[model samples]
Target: MNSASVISVVGPTGTGKSALALSLAEILDGEIVNADSMQFYRGMDIGTAKVSVAERRGIAHHLLDILDVTEEASVSDFQRQARQAIAEIQGRGKRAILVGGSGLYVRAVLDVLEFPGTDPRIRQRLEVEAEAHGMAELRARLQRVDPASAERVADDRRVIRALEVHEVTGKPFSSFMPVREYIQPTVQIGLDIPRPVLHERLSTRVNQMVDQGLADEVERLDQRGLRTGKTAGRALGYAQFLRVLDGEATVAAAAEETIIATRQFARRQSTWFRADPRIRWLDPREDDVVDQAAALCL
Candidate 1:
């Protein structure tokens, strides 16, 4: 890896990426840049498992807690902000360590990705159509217009965006997909964990979040227009806990649901990162994992 190139720590959730990133930063004289989309929002700490200030060990971190709960996160915006942060860090003669499980957000920063322009009129029309007709209806439209994106994208938001892009740009949204080519000389370190162990860790983590007042955190954010926020409202634990606040589920039931959802999300994340051939995979269980990762950076 080039001495000035950014280092990324990526993998599924609960795989100890943050701890490794912190260690790498300490060893390499690096600053941390968050790539997790959910971690962008303020007052979302507990459920997102955002590292606390003290846990940072005086290391400088960027792109975290910069948005309110009501705002939607944009990958295009994150790309700009993260690149600027990386450039500044490099200019200061320090390494830049990017860390998160959000696959697309990470790619947006490190890979040659370009976002298509958006028109409010087209977006609003699509949103209204989705609300009136349903996501299945829009997804069917997406399937007809951009079958590749339709097959790959599973979220309602991306489904609508795909359709909007096809309409506005006269091209398939998949055409804008990033190639694996990196924009800079970079090294990605992925943490590999056993499936059964990851499942248990996710379950235990969700239960611990509940114990650590995930419910209270959700309740507080709900007052701050969390439900009105399109992106934040759908976050794994927050969504289930919101059901609890609505009397639709109990805390125990919400925690169980969150565990299942998080496991599924982790599986998707693992699949995404696994597809990238450039990342160096390491077993986090090994005692020399940090040393192995540092050696790769050098």
Candidate 2:
């Protein structure tokens, strides 16, 4: 790692990404950095599966729960905080182990994106359009405007973001996501799990979260006056549960809907990682993930 490299763990949720990263941190003398966007909140613990201090076990973790739920933390903020975390870990003669399923957050921190600073007017107007015309409409707009880019990222969030970039930077958003030169000499590892098994695990996890008072957690956060527009508020489980609260769906329906949405999101994540040529993919159950990862780093 040349004393300054970062170790990145990425994949869909239920792929043992956190477990693998924590294990690798202990073995490799590394400090864990939170890369998941939802885990960055303080109160939403169970649903986010935030690593407990006991789980961290004093190995030194960074950039988790640094912002209040009300604050709007952007990709730029993640990049800034992540660099500081890596520098601190490197300064201590330890490797930095990044752990999460938030590929955009990981990519932003690793500088895979040439991430132009956002223009407020462009974002504000687009956000308004997204709210008015719906995610589908905005996605169609992106397809019409940038067909090639649309094929790569058809999600509502990415579509809106691409439109914002085009409006502000006069360039397509896909340009930033593929700027691989911005990355350090990072060793990327992925956890591979079968699709059906992954779906079962996600369903079980969501149920466990509900039993762990996920509803109460969301209610508390809601009372804090956090807006729906904020990223933290739109976390997978919480976002769907809010629909139940609004009488739009039953609790069971919400849970099932969340599971389906998550699985689809996972598929998209898998595709995104596939497009990156530098990553080394592996399975948690096959051999030692650490041994395989260490071999790659060396």
- Candidate with top lDDT is 1
lDDT of 2: 0.79
The local distance difference test score of each candidate is 0.95, 0.79
Expressed as tens digits, the lDDT of each residue in 109-213 for candidate 1 is: 999999999988999999999899889889988899899999999888898899889988999999999999999999999997999999999999998899899
Give candidate 1's TM-score.
Answer: 0.98
Q: Which portions of model 1 miss their true places by more than 4 Å?
A: none
Worst 10 residues of 1 by lDDT: 1-10
* Residue 68 alpha-carbon offset, candidate 2, angstroms: 2.7
lDDT of 2 at 50: 86
Residue 180 displacement (Å), model 1: 0.5
